[model samples]
Target: MEPGAETLYAYANRRRREITEGVNGGSGRIVPVTIAAGTFPFPIDATTRNAIASAATATTLAGGDAYTVPSWLLPTGRFITLDATAIVVVALAISVAFQAVFSAQAAAFAGIADGSVTTHEAVDAILGS
Candidate 1:
């Protein structure tokens, strides 16, 4: 039988704490992804997050349809070039993934509070695959 939501909540909470502490199940905070330009190891540290936000805003303000992230911005020393349409698609995908996780986390919390949690469904539902 699958573990209950309470157990899943505990596991998720611990993982979240570990990620905050830069452990992340020994993978650390870097989230590596492959775009058309190349692979980018996106660090989730505060500094990098801030930089990404600033860069995203700058891209919007620059009024350009295309944005080319320089190689230096990537941990793998590769570039990421995306036009506005592609950027939107990528951003939507990311947003959807985050929404799923957050929704699951919230559902777990609510289940814990109300004693309504049942069996586990799938990894993709509770957490992104």
Candidate 2:
């Protein structure tokens, strides 16, 4: 038996409403996708898709904290490479300063115990050292 016109039209309208509601209600939800690093490999029309793809890489897009594209994929205007050497140098400097401070404190305490320096003098030396 054939379906009636009213039943068919109602079914189509219900399906349309279901699709529209699903799209609107799920806004701001995280959807997972994968893309390689360093290339605008995704279609331009879908921003969400591109963002998800870009976030898979360590290098973030320039002008924004959020990774919008792989560093390689971005135009020179759109992205900047992180300074790994600068980071390493700063880390080393911090480590050396910490070591120096601790060594000075230990030496000052030792000197105070050996009677080579007074307690008050040791405290001042530790602070300056």
The candidate that wins on lDDT is 1
Q: How well is each residue in 16-61 modelled by candidate 1, as lDDT tens digits?
A: 4444324633432455555565545665544555555555666687
Overall lDDT per candidate, in order of appearance: 0.52, 0.36
Please estimate how well model 2 matches the true structure, expressed as its whole-model Cα lDDT. 0.36
Candidate 2: tens digits of C-alpha lDDT, residues 50-107: 4433443322233334323224222224542323332223234333443444465556
Q: Which segments of candidate 1 are over 4 A away from where they belong? A: 1-12, 17-48, 72-92, 116-129
* Candidate 2 off by > 4 Å: 1-82
- The TM-score obtained by model 1 is 0.51
* Cα-based TM-score, every candidate: 0.51, 0.35
Provide the clashing-pair count of each candidate structure.
0, 4
Lowest lDDT 10-residue stretch of candidate 2: 27-36
